[model samples]
Each structure stands twice: as structure tokens, then as C-alpha cells.
Target: MEKKQRMSRRSEQMGDQIEERIVTGVYPPGMRLDETELASGFGVSRTPVREALIQLASAGLVEIRPRRGAIVAEIGQHRLYEMFEVMAELEAMCGRLAARRITESEQRALVAAHQACEAARDANDPDAYYQRNERFHHLIYAASHNVFLEEQAAALHRRLRPYRRLQLRVRDRMGTSFSEHAGIVEAILAQDGELAATRIRTHVVVQGQRFADLIASLPMLGSPSLT
Candidate 1:
């Protein structure tokens, strides 16, 4: 493969690893990411690690400073609220369109996705539930059948990854989140476009606020990466 292709592939792999680490809480927000350390761990050169960091930055995963290097971007309460508003709108749009355009197969997949989430919750596995919850939303995006909307929603989703995981930190959130997912599916199954949209929007926004509150209640939430 050409150098560019090699670099692209490395970036993709590194990006996925970084995302997993962040989502699994291995690397918390505002935590400095040492490129040299990553490079050694990946058995690659710092050049590729630098490229991966840049990729993460573009995905809103990290921020590069003048001399301090790259650190995971901290989701502040203000940005968290703004991201929630945007995500709620995006999810609402998806729900509205999916109600009109969702195929039988896609609808089945949505049901299965939610069921998987419920199973994870019942098993008391926050890790599994968190993963499935992500898929559930992504399945909704696929059902919508709007390329632009899917891309926008996906980008926003990437940006909100940290907070999304932290949402599960709320007390009894597994059951509560599962209930919210049930409501969303109920609206979709009924083909209630307006209701589906409204419910999903409220669900997303409330989760966003809840995440913000969770962080605020934390004794120490690292430090601000951007500000």
C-alpha cells in the first residue's frame, strides 16, 4: 500500500481504539494523551500517532494545544446543553422521517436493538447496555434513510460520546433509560411521526441535562481541555 493508504488505515484503527478507550472510561475527559506513549504502545512511529490525534481532534475527541499536546476535549455543561439541543433535533428528525420511510426490516432491527439493550440492562451490564444503546440510535438513523441527516447525526453523535457514556452514571439510569427507549419504540411502532419525534427529542435533551448534572456533581472532572 501507498504511504497515504497506510497512514489512513492506521488512523482508522487508532481512532477506533481511542474511541473505545474513551467510551470505556479508560481515558477520561481533559486527560492528556501522550502521543509518544501511544506510539510505543501501538508499535508505530510518533508520526502516525500524531496523525491519529489529528483525526480524533476532527472527530471532537481531543484538542491539540500549542505546547501541551493533545488532551481529550472536556464536555462542559454549556457545550453539553448545546450538543443536546442539536442531537435532540437530529434524533427527532430521524424519528419523523423513519416513521414515514422505515422499511419492515429496518423496523424489525430497531425492535431487536432495543430488545438487546433491555437484555443488557436486565443482566445488570452497563457496558453492554451502553454499547447497544449506541446501536439503537444508529439503527434509527438507518431507518430514516436520509444520507445527509445520517451523516449529520453521526457526527454529532461522535462529538457527544463522552457524555453519552456518563449518562449511565445517573442513579437507576439503566431502568430509566430503558423506559425511555421503550417509549421511543412505542411511538415508532405506532407510526406516530409527531409523537415519535417529540418523545425522542425530549429523551435526548433530558439525557444531556442529566449528564451535565452528573459531571457537575463529580468531585473532580479532570480539567477543561479547551477553556
Candidate 2:
């Protein structure tokens, strides 16, 4: 059991390293991940590397083929737009519901999450801000007090995490995200459901555009050719 637990931890760490590279453009979309090379690079046996690749595949970040091994999954422009549209509407619904039903405690948690994001921004750490930003949105989802809605929103949020993180690389995006968060918090605090819904939708939809711009600007992808 102990040995198995250690192997699990190693695989998780290896998976995180690979996922970080994919998210940060180190391993851009459509790049093939060679298992033998990964094993050597990670200084581990092939087993852990294979396990990590499988985990990444399940997250939709990597695709596994019988002959081709694992390659990073590409988010085409049309599919990207569709996902963002759905994400925007889902978040808008959460915001509207949260505004109508948030308890005082939940409201405080939302404020704390926003403050955490602000701290990350002040520190000039986009990675940290991204982590806090998810917490902020999740808090709002929970505040909605709708189990089904929260589950759906959380699942979609996880799927979109990588692209969303990439958006933070856009110039001054962290600052802009924080400003948008301020508006969202204000509307929610005031119990203005419509305004909250609108603000959240705009915030999410704008992120979709920022993500597109980031992809287009990447020297590696070279003109956002959707695969």
C-alpha cells in the first residue's frame, strides 16, 4: 500500500508538470508528447510517465492514439467560441441566482475570494491570480445555493481552466480581470440580479476574446490556425 501510494504521488506530480507545460505553451497544441523522452526528462520509469499521459488525456488536454501516442489537444476557433458562449451564459445564471439568494456568510466568502485575487494581482502573479479567480467564481456558484447549477458550472469551469489561464498572459489582463470582478461583486452585493448577470456574462465573453488574441499572437501557433 505504501509503495502504491508513492507511485500515485509520483504520477500526480509528473502529470502536474506536463499539464503546466501544456497550459503555458511550453507544449503547444498539436505537439506530440513522446513517452520515452518524457520518461528520460522526468527521470522516472515509463510507468509513471504513461500514467501521467493517461490522466492528461482524461482532462481533454491530451489525445492518445494507438500509433501516435499522446498529442496535445487543439481547441479550434469555432469550438472555442461555442464553449465560451456556453460558459458565459452559465456564469451569468450563477451570478443572477447568487445575487438573489446569497447568505451573509456566502457574501463574505465571495469578498474574501475577490480580495485574494486582488492580492495576487498586486503581487504581479498571474498564476496566483488565476487560482484565486476560480475560487471567486466558485464561491459565487456556491452562493447560488443550487446544487445542480453549481455542479454543471464547476465541471465546465474545469474544462476551460487551461485556456482561461492562457488569457492572463495577455497584456494587463490580470488588472482588467480584477476590475471586472469589482463590478461583479458590487452588483451581487447590491442584490441587482440583472446587473450581476450582465456583468458576469460580459466578463466571461471578454475572456473568450482575450484567449483568441493570445492564441493568435503566439509565435509558435503563428496565426491561430484552428486544428
Candidate 3:
């Protein structure tokens, strides 16, 4: 059982790495993902690579075909916009509920997560900030005390992870993101549900110039890849 669990975890980690590469244009859309190559790159067996590919396929990041093996899927910009719109609303709901329901312990944890994000931002490390940022948002979701809502939010959050990480790579985005997180933390701590909701919505929703920036940063479909 322990060995099986370890394999599962390895597969999940492999899937995450593959997802990151795809989102960052290292593995562009429609690029063939050979299991043996992936396994060799990660220094793992083909079994975990295959399992990871399956997981990515389920997430719509990779498509599995009879003869084509696993290929990266081309996610349309419009569809991404739609997903972000829904994500904004879901995060807003989580923020609102968290403000009303958060306990002292959860609040402390949330603050700690924010502080970690601050450290990452100060260091000018987008990758570090991205990981800490995820923790900060997750703490709020847990503080909401709504299991169903938390589950839904987490699911969408996972699907949008690649885009969110990419967004963080934009110039000065890490600092801006950390600043927005400060406002969110303040509202939740103040127990101002409406303000928390509004702040979180604004933080998550890409609009106007922000949307344009994200679209411009996206890797072009069918781009050449060395992988």
C-alpha cells in the first residue's frame, strides 16, 4: 500500500512538471509527448510517465489518441477567458465566506501564507511567489468552511494553475499580486465579507488591459519546440 501511494504521488508530481512545461511553451500545443522521453527526462520509469500522461489527458492538457500517443492540447484564448471569469466568481465566494467563518487559527495561517508571499516578492522570484501565492489562496478556501465550495474552487484552481503561473511571469506582476493579496488579507481579517469578495474578484479577474497582456504572453499554437 505504501509503495502504491508513493507511485501515485510520483505520478502526480510528474503530471505537474509536464503541465508546467506545456504552459511555458517548452512543450507547445500539438507537440508529441513520448512516454519514454518523459520518463528519461524525469529519471523515472515509463509506468509513472504513462500514468502522468493519463492524468494530464483527464485535465484536458494532453490528448491521447490511438496512434498519436499523448499530444499537448491547444487551449483557445476565449475558453481560457471563460474559465478565468468563472474562477473569479468562485474565488470571490470563497473570500466572502472566509471573512465570515474564519477562525483565529485559520486567520493566522492565512497571514503566514501572505507573509511568505511577501518574502518571495521581495526576493523578486516569481516562481517562489507562485508557490506561496497558491498557499495563501488555499488557506482562504479552507477558512470558508464550505467543503463543497472549497472542492469546486480547488478543482478550477488546479485547471487554471498553468495560466496563473504564466501570468506571474509578466513584468512587475509578482509585486502587484502581492499588493493585491495584502488588501484581501486585510478585508478578511476585518471580517468585511462584501469588501473581501470585491477585492478577491478584482484580484482574480483578468480584464481589459490585463486580459490583453495575458493573451499576448501566451505561447502561439503550433510553435516549434526542441522537446
**TM per prediction:** 0.78, 0.84, 0.91
The worst-scoring run of ten residues by lDDT in candidate 2 lies at 218-227
| Candidate 1 lDDT over residue span 164-191, tens digit each | 7667767688898899999999998888
lDDT, candidate 2, equals: 0.86
State the lDDT at 122 in candidate 1: 89
Clashes of each: 0, 0, 0
* Reference-based lDDT, residue 24, model 3: 71
Q: State the lDDT of candidate 3 residue by residue for 1-227, as single tens digits.
A: 99999999999999989888887788998899999988998999999899999988877788999998999998777778788999999999999999999999999999999999999999988889999999999999999999999999988998888789889988888989999999999999999999999999999999898887887777733322321
Clashing residue pairs, candidate 3?
Answer: none
Candidate 1 TM-score, true structure as reference: 0.78
- Ranking of predictions according to TM-score: 3, 2, 1
Q: For candidate 2, what's the RMSD?
A: 2.9
1 or 3, which is superior by lDDT? 3
